[model samples]
Target: MYDIAVVGGGPAGLSAAVQARARNKSVLLVSGDVRDNPLYRTERVDNYLGFYNRSGRELLEAFRSHADAMGVQLREGRVLNILPVGDTFYLSIGSEVEQARAVVLATGVARGRKFPGEAEYLGRGVSYCATCDGMLYRNREVVVVGRAADAPHEANYLRELGCKVTYVSAQPPEGLRPDIPFVKGNRVEIQGGRNVEAVRVDRATIPCEGVFILRSSMAPDDLMTGLELENGYIRTGRDGATAIPGVFAAGDCTGVPLQVSKAVGEGQVAGHRAAEYCDAQQREEKTEDKERM
Candidate 1:
């Protein structure tokens, strides 16, 4: 088990891992494969302390390199769930389960709006990670909701999984490659109460075995469950503590003041707090061992 496992490759997760290591703890950094960040491509962030007018990507890369230089072990995996076990935390990352003394959930959200029945069929027939669930619908028709450049690639991913994909768009396909059939509409609705029975748009029912929502923007809670969220942000304490012990969440997960610099500062505090928590655990283990002997 690692001393700390940070569940994001974004700004906050990276910063937390670096500081945790500085406190001499074993660190594992897990991230989704969104290497080409969508936010960095558009925004011009000039309020940053250094680099008066630096692109977000330029700033992000520098931090990534710093974490790499510090010998932080980077692991690529999409976290599905995080559960607090006895004196340890277990993270369900796709097919693997990782245990760590401390956990930092820095997975920034990839969700837009919370629609009814959206979370009900979470793993039933509806899924988020197409790569993981696409195989189940092999040779069957599937639907993708969203009109970003990611639509084509997501469709391709489903195709590679041996499933026929139909890209559903809330808007007319713009600037995107025009190879796949883009079902253009204003609002894409998933028509069902409990499990995804069908997708309805203007009295038209498009039947599908599965539905994958790929909306462009994301909010904080879009990543993990079992957290107290207030206005789409993870709630935290003055000590940077969360509801779960040994799971010190910081940055956007703790919500509010969602800026890069503020996030980094919170990360440093969480990292140190996690380090202290781990150390206390180790000392307790030693005492227990002595008593056993």
Candidate 2:
């Protein structure tokens, strides 16, 4: 288990991981494919202090290098869920689970709102991680809603798993298996009663037993319940501490301006505070043990 788990690899998450490592805490930074990060695609970023006229990818690479030098463990995957039990936060990344004493949520703004009936059937017949639920739908029909950069790959995986996979997205999917049919649709909705019966893609309705809505980043609140939000952003204090103890938030997930500088500053605060929280938890556990004796 790590002392802190940062759920993003953008400027904020990298900064948080670096700060936590600076405090002598073990940190695990989990993020999706780099191509999915908004900053990675930007042509130029001139606002960040001391890094004028640098491309977003260049700045991101620098941040990643700093975090790597600080001994922060990096994992590439989308965090499907975060369950806080006791003082430990259990993060479900794909089919694996990681434990941490504190969590730093820097998941940039989750683009697009939920589709109709998406939330109602979240666990019934809908899922986010194809790796985790692919086997269940083997030989069964399923729709893969392609949103992130790796969605096509996931669709291909499902097809390989013997699932009759149908890929649906706003644009045509690249790298999708030729056998897997692709549907072009901008407006999509999940439809079902009791369980997912089908997915409605624009003018087409495809019958399926399961639907995988793959997105680069799940909303902070969706990942962890009880996370307070203000105007669609994760609400946080100046120190980046959220209402949930031992859980802090920073960067675009916390609010606007959404500048690289703001993200880095907030990340520093969140990482430091998370490290302190871990220390306090350790102290409390020690005290309780002594009292028990």
Candidate 3:
């Protein structure tokens, strides 16, 4: 178990990991492909404090190098869920589960708005995690609305379960199963009656039993089932503290200017606070053991 688990490998996440390590706490940094971050698409960033007219790629590389030099353990995967198990948090990452005393969410806001009828039909026929719900649709038709790198894999997972999976996206997804039927729709909507009945893409309608909306980053509220959210952003204080005791949030996921500077500062505070929280939990547990003795 790590003392702190920092999600997202962008500037904020890296900063958090580095700071937590500086506090002598064991840190685990979980992230997907760095390029998946919208920041990587930026042509150039000119307003950063130290760097002037630096390409996003260059700045990101620097951030990564610094984290690596600091001995931060980086794990590559998207976090599916965060559950509070007693004093620690259990993070479902891709296919693995990791335990951490404290967690810092730096997942940037690549989360898009829900499709029409999507929320209304959730659980009845809609899902955010294909892996979590794919088995239920075995041998049945399903539509996957993918906007992240893992969409193709989720589609394939569904197909392996004997699901007749049709993938819908604005553009062709990388690493998608070539055999799965692909639909290119810039704007797709869900149509259902009691349960999901069809997916409308432009003028075409494809019937399906379920629809899955997959994104690069899980929304904060979705990641931590009962976490508080304000206007779709994780509700956080200046120190990145959240309603959940051990779970803190920083970066674009917290809201506002969405600048690297703000993220870095928030990360520093979050990491420090998380380290302190973990240390306190450790001390309390030790005291309890002593009392028992």
Clashing residue pairs, backbone N/CA/C < 3 A, model 1:
111-218
Off by over 4 Å in 2: none
Kindly list the per-residue Cα lDDT of model 3 for residues 24-68, writing each as its tens digit: 999999998776887787899998998999988898888888988
lDDT by residue for model 1 (1-293), tens:
89999877777878888999898899998875554344356357777687677778887878788988888888765676677778988877755788899887676655456555567777766776666677889988777775344556777777777776767776664444454566766555665655677766555667777888754333544544566777766777875667667777777666666678877778888888888999999999999999999
Per-model lDDT: 0.72, 0.94, 0.88
lDDT of 1 at 253: 62
lDDT of 3: 0.88
- Span of 10 residues, lowest total lDDT, candidate 1: 215-224
lDDT of 2 at 94: 94
Best of the two (1, 3) by lDDT = 3
**Which segments of model 3 are wrong by more than 4 Å?**
none
User: Residues 61-100, candidate 2, lDDT per residue (tens digit)?
Assistant: 9899999999999999999889999889999999999999
Give the higher-lDDT candidate: 1 or 2.
2
RMSD of each: 3.2, 1.0, 2.3
User: Can you give the TM-score per candidate against the true fold?
Assistant: 0.84, 0.97, 0.89
